[model samples]
Target: MAWDYKVIDGSEEKTDLGFRDEPALNHKRTRILDACKRRDIDDLQALAISRGGFLTDAIRCQAWPILLGVHVDQRGEQDGISDSWTTLKKHRDEGQVKLDVNRSFVYYPNDDTQAQLDEKKSQLSDLITEVLRRQPYLCYFQGYHDICQVFLLVLPPATRAAAVARLSALRIRDFMLPSLNPSVAQLRLIPDILRAADPTLYAHVSRTEPFFALPDTLTMFAHNVRRYSDIARLFDALLAREQAFTLYVFAQIVLRRRDELFLQDEPDMLHFTLSKLPQDLDLDALIVNTAALFERFPPESLRSWRSVSSSSTLKTVRDVSACAAQTLEDGHRFFEKHHRELIWAQRRDKVLRTAWANRALILAVVVGAGAVYFRKAPIWSNLAWSVPDHYF
Candidate 1:
């Protein structure tokens, strides 16, 4: 039920800017790629944890899919390349997806030209839509786009959908479920992680709403961390380790800000402070602390904190593999029984929704709503909303 923790020792060397030097980083990159070539998962994972992460974008493109357990051939197969775009046409979440896409320009750096930002946003929308179409059973949460944006930037377009699909089905599986119940279950692990890492800080935060950890969990730190580059580095390390390791990283973030959080006694103030991450956070140190925390209190010890039989816990690659297989089987059964009716209904609903959205857009434009139209559209109603039972 728990993972075997491998402790990484020795101090890491870094430059004045807090990054490892080029030669040392290149060495880590080489080892990671070599491990991938040999399909040596243990070595890749060890390097990821010990070295902190992959060194460059080039290295992540090659290493990330391997870490996510995605196969080269499986990309097109899982995405169903033949009809993916067609299926996307019928996605009930399309309206909400566009709203989220419009807000995703923040993923780009402020200095970039509007043209570059627009291109990236368009690519992001396409990639997310493709992934959703392939895995129609997975619900699209509001912050899910933040996580997908990372892949769109790092991985090649050809591999992005498959990589994101595997990631959603594996490490982030619980969050993509039909309801928020599983996500809440995952967030509950934060306190348990904090209790193991730093008991005093754990007690202080336990008194507040644990929902402060929600954004970090849902967005994979993409929402919290301002810099895209920093988020990529953090994700490089996260993707390399077991899925549950993110709990430790988040706990480390809390402990890093314990001085500020400790001063706030009110739940509202504590939540507010925790929600907005500091811009100047030293990511390298946080990653080091996260790895150290994992070594100190592995998943085995945390499982004892589970209060209910249905509670979700940290899953290993093997466990995830089994779960993915079962999920695929269930999808096949569901398709066999209801594919015809579901496809027809989805198509009909898509037509109605698209017409409604078009008419609303036209009305807003005629009324001179301008930017307000995009921001105040009824798509916001989808916030905190789930699909109807029939759709599920």
Candidate 2:
């Protein structure tokens, strides 16, 4: 529901950065700022990779082109044509904060020469000023919106500085990094944890007559469900529902093992192992498989085949060797399943009520207009009721 990083500061050796170190920190921040001034995302990225602190990842990401490749390939789609152009206008009119990249990005084509690039970079220095000032909020800043553009959209000119300082100092990015997704890393542990939680069901599922791991999950539980249209939106809708309930249980497991997962364990290597080559592993199998660690009836829920269906009532508990049990669905309210409809219904009701309230006001406005134009109106039009009954 909310980002956790804004609260959790990175692990650091020293708590205090007193007067003597302030100048050096400023010098380092300044050197990167200066290089950014020179239209050198290249140098800026190098400085980021070389440094290791809270801001390191942000610096590396912003300057990734320099770290990964020289050409700075256009890998992602630019937002939209009109949208892209309008952004520059908004920045000029609203952002007020200067960036080192604006004019260069706007006037010169992206395929421009070196000198034009440098000029644009000078204009865009406001970007650094903006981020350095807002220090705490940067990491949770959504992608697709340029941090500069978002600043203009959300904050007034005065508040912009403090917002960017909050952004640059945010630890949100650590949890959001490609490798560090906690859900994926903890998924594999689901099966083992489930085995520990309920050994009999684990044994039944493992060595019994009717046992099957989720068929589609090849590498650590990635789903390969049949895609019916442009996307597997239907499956995702189901996954979302089940996942809501799953997170409630998984949080319990993860919280109990917080020391092992987030603290004591080797974070870097753990990230690589859990993550796949192209994309990371999934959490579903672990959750579902852990669900399977309970004694299941016919074991059909884990299978994607709707053609061969069965119902399951087995619910696993926290303790080991506990018998599979059924928790009644009576009075159970699963929010994720019906949330969209609930939201739509609420909105529709609100709109209807608002419209009903507005109608009397609309009628009064009409009566006022009629009174204002009373002189111009034909007497017959106003006196229609006087003659209408006799005519009828």
Candidate 3:
């Protein structure tokens, strides 16, 4: 069950066994297992971000639930747990989920037969449908299946549904909204982070919109990173930290390629290069650097912090996630409140845009009529000018 890592120089040599010290793999595994046994979440979180992430998926099966604030021992025991989520109710996004699920397993389990892949896709669809139906408020985005498939591949069947539900409601709820605005707001943090961490590179790439990072941050890099092992390692750190940590990881990615990014003269070139991550990314180093950047410039210190309101799930989820008393109920309440506010804001914006358009049209018509009258009635125009001159 050891994870494989290729050498950095395009060589076929498998250099990393998912541990810094080869002998310490077993020692680290023992400590992780002990933490699981003791249910020591703090220690586990520290270990997850340390040198090699939870080592193997076998360990992740136990550690991930703990990170998401779910107890692996008490699987399916959450309040309102039921079989009806999969069978009785139908979510609005189930159709989209089926379409995406059919396209799942495109990158991982390289040796799976067609039948095995089909089975996993069916399970992936069921898992997503279960969450969306139960939390009818959550809207399914296209790449959601990418994130869900990681859970499906790693966690057991009984544990998968609750874990995905908690993750959706808490971790990635911003992306599942009726619109992508909340998620875009989160991407805005990347520029602020780069501005603080590497001002030169930030200035170099300032012309580009943060949309280049949408694929990475929106799906938690599940859609961008092709390897299952690489993404699982990434999720280890993402789950262990605050929700905003994904932006920092992406900022680190940009900073890592400062030299290459600097060479690109046009903003479009910079954006195109950054839209996708490097295939040979050293995730362990990237994770470590992200932690340092986060510590150096925490979310509150960022210039973009003022842009995200206190009521946003971006802020609310981060606030409750670290609290001992936080529950899935808190996530549900926050989502409902945010959803209402977003709908209201959209309506207000629509009204304002319509009003402005009408005002512009009316102003244009008045100007047009005045021109026509002046052209047709030169005497009136002369009188108007004479009167203004006499008054002045």
Pick the TM-score winner: 3
Alpha-carbon deviation at 263 in model 2, angstroms: 12
Residue 237's lDDT in candidate 2: 17
Ranking by lDDT: 3, 1, 2
TM-score of each: 0.72, 0.18, 0.85
lDDT leader:
3
Candidate 2 lDDT by residue in tens digits, 1-392? 11111111122212221224455656665676566446453354334323221122233223322211112225432111113222332222224333223432332123446774554354335544434332221122222123333233223333433333322222112222223222232233334443555554334333321112211121111122211110111122111122223322332233233343333234444333222222221333333443344334222233222221111101211211111111111101111222334365569989999988898998899999988787567884677656767588
In model 1, what are the clashing residue pairs, if there are any? none
Ranked candidates, highest TM-score first: 3, 1, 2
**C-alpha lDDT of candidate 3 relative to the true structure:** 0.80
Q: Over the stretch 1-392, how does candidate 1's per-residue lDDT look in tens digits?
A: 11111111111222233334656655666788898788676676666656446655666777787776666654444333455475454566867888998888584555557777788788888887877777777678888888988788778777787788777765676676555655676677788878877788888888776798888878888877876667877897787776677877888888888899889998788888877877887777777778788888876678544541122325433243343333433433433333344455568989989978799777877778656665576775574255576765
